[model samples]
Target: MRTILAAGALALALGASGIAFAEPVKVGMITTLSGGGAGLGVDARDGFMLAIKLSGSKDIEVVTEDDAMKPELAVQIADKMIQSDKVDVLTGIIWSNLAMAVVPNAVAQGKFYLSVNAGPSPLAGAKCDKNYFNVAYQNDNFHEAAGNYAQTEGIKKMFILAPNYPAGTDSLNGFKRYYKGELVGEVYTKLGQTDYAAEIAQIRASGADSVFFFLPGGMGIAFMKQYAQSGVGIPVMGPGFSFSQDVLAAIGDAALGAKNTASWSPDLDNPKNKEFVEAFKTEYNRLPSIYAAQAFDTGTLLAAAAAKADVKDADAFRAALAAAEFDSVRGKFKFNTNHHPIQDFYVREVVKNDEGVLTNKIVATSFTDHTDAYAAECKL
Candidate 1:
């Protein structure tokens, strides 16, 4: 009888603890893993998983899938994660189009969606949802920083280009919003186009004093190689995506001397950032890119919230996430009313480190405590 009474008392104590009996929070990660853009997604996934591993929390369970850079595939995976896997949160999209396809519906269905890389304007503006949060900069933020830098550099005539997609359009528009200069030419190429011969010919003939572009991944690599060989020499610049750590070595010395805008760099001086950079290099044997930093910040944000409230309690969890109590690697991170980050943007220049490897270093700050222009449009 004493044993039975003792067992009942222990059960009561366990039940009173609440979280001890709560199911682990499941996170669904759908990211590009097999395509031209794989490097971005792989770094994002690695950074996020590294944070989870470092936390040593068995209460967080992550399920990962490859989206293959396709919007349709991402949609199908998000639906399966919500209905079958019963994920408490969804994240790890690297492209803006895939985020547009997955984020709104997932959040509408009551699953919190945290962005690792993509931040489309519609989601930040008219279609803002309480459950949707963007840990990365808005798609236009970095481009706008480039524009500001160009003005500082006294480049009055510039040529600009990007792929013909939603993000591409946003990139040029953001540049124009801040440049306050004459555009000698503006061009949008096909998405994922590896050859930039004709574009280089056009750039050479444009008579622009400088050139700015927004090509990312393999596209940037191809363009930089071809442009270097063609001898355009117009002083190329762009957002950091065109010259991120994942693609820097591939770009080689052609990327040297080019200036780009980014929110984080390996040389950023902060305690949390220092730890993250060192730990990431030790874990992966490579430098972390801007995408990786954003993903790591997202994971840290989730961990802080999870520690404060159970995922099953929607209001409590949402409030805790809004509080954003984590020590972000970005130094100063806070969410706007639209749930997008408001942080500093810096101008980074590609330079060879002591080891002769291409890397970025902060040369100037373009904007401080920067808020997205579309934040006011968001009703939430």
Candidate 2:
């Protein structure tokens, strides 16, 4: 009878200490792991895994898959995660098109979708779902900041270019929303087009005071190299996607002094950011890009939310996620009504580091406490 009583007491003590056994939380990450955009997804996945490792949480099981940057493939993977694997959370899509294809459907099926990148406008607006959360900024945030910076710099006639896709359109529209300058020319190139000789020729003839382009990944590296060789001599401006750490080495001196906008940077002044940068560099032997920072924050956010509520209780888990008690590497982290981040955007310039490696340095703040334009349209 004493042994039974002692065992009961020990069990009660463990329960009261919040150390009761719980089922492992299952997570599914689908990102572009191959092809032109692989670098971005690789960084995101590395950062996320690093956070999970640092947390030392044995109760979290992550399943990662490569989407190859295909929207249909991403959709299929989302279905598998939801129906077959029964993952509680889904995250890590690098492209807007892929996110659009997977996020809404997955969320509608009662799975929480935390976006580490690719915050398409539709998801941030009328189609917003309670189960969807964007750890990254809205798709337009950085582009809008670029526009504001262009206006501040007194750029009278700016030429703009982007790939012909949903994100490309959003990027150009975001720039136009705040630029308030005459557009000398606007061009939409085919996605993944390598040669920019034709585009450079047009820019040279457009008589524009400055040029802004939204070609990310390998496309950005190709364009910068060609543009420099073309000798257009026009100052280049863009969002951070085109100038991130993952691609800067490839872009080389061609991107030097180029200014871009972003919500997070490796040099951001905050305790969380400092730790993240140091740890990321040590683990990956590379600087963490905005994509990586967002992914890392996603992991931290999930760990915090999971601690507060069990994944089996959807409502409770959602509430904990909405509470957002995690320390963000971006410094000020909060979700707007649409589940999109409301944060500051800063202009960054490409500069050579002490080791002569190309990287971005924060130059100025472009927007403060900025929320997405589509938040008003979201009924949720």
Candidate 3:
């Protein structure tokens, strides 16, 4: 367990009298930090800690652990964090399967789970809980945006593939929800798969005009590199995870001109986003990824809620969190009935920046003030 120290120019007072609380708010973060998906988890941790540091609240103490991309390990870490650490809030999970193993248990045990990423459909639908909130996005939101983009572009037959995990399955389902096109092929690869020789052969034979995939982290890096080498001429696209800042350079020109969808971008014209991007780059000496942005938003939202209500008061704190009164990096951010984000999703094309670094630029807005399809099914 590591304690993150707060240091920044921004000052935040926790109580109504503008003073720090007697007892600190304890946060437990269980995420992948040493595996194929380590990059995503590392960025999430850095971005979340950065936001907490910038909030300048000495009352927030975070204890973190590496889950190593295993469900059992994540469950063990979550139990330790909640029982031994006595954490007030649980956050910072990157994968949906791990979240499934931890969130319901943590929330049911009276710990608030402010999800930084991995908003599984079950959590957002009939099984919704008052103590669990997803500050990032629903697992399907980004893929749905990509589907809308493909529909607008008049894509006829699309070949899509994803890892055979909760998030991966949600990705393809979301795409199919909004993509008014015939599916040439749909393949489910192994989670954390590194090779694409077999998938590439299938894609080539499918004769699809375009391809969509949901391989993230090192898997994306490996797949894009192998896909490039395969010499298959089909245009490829996916959600922002595949082309995030952490993996873009590794993907190199393979991701160039590929369109992806996201809720927030570094270039988003908002004061909070501008400050966050500058602070992230200055503090970390590198650009932040979509995972980072979501985690940062989670931290900032918690800070805002902490300012209004004490973590000990469940009802007040839940109301404060649901209010979502913080300025988000993505403009016009709000929470739906299901505790998922209702915001704009944009289609961004991968392009080389003026500094010759591969990055994304918003090409079109796919959905504005969009709520997840499952929100209506949520009773809460």
Which one is best on lDDT? Answer: 1
Q: Which stretches of candidate 3 lie over 4 Å from their true place?
A: 1-18
C-alpha displacement of 70 in model 1, angstroms? 1.1
TM-score for each of the candidates: 0.96, 0.96, 0.93
* Model 2, backbone clash pairs (residues 3+ apart or across chains), number: 0
- Name the runs in model 1 displaced over 4 angstroms: 1-8, 15-22
Candidate 3's TM-score reads: 0.93
> Could you tell me the TM-score of candidate 2?
0.96
The local lDDT score (0 to 100) that residue 197 gets in candidate 3 is: 97
| Per-residue lDDT of candidate 3, residues 19-102 (tens digit) | 354467899998889967888899999999999999887888999999998989999998898888999999988888889889
Give lDDT tens digits, candidate 1, residues 260-280: 999999888999999998899
Model 1 lDDT at residue 326: 89
- After superposition, the stretches of candidate 2 with alpha carbons farther than 4 Å from their true spots are 1-13
Error of 1 at 221 (Å): 0.3
- What is the model-wide C-alpha lDDT for candidate 2? 0.92
Order of quality (TM-score): 1, 2, 3
lDDT of each: 0.92, 0.92, 0.90
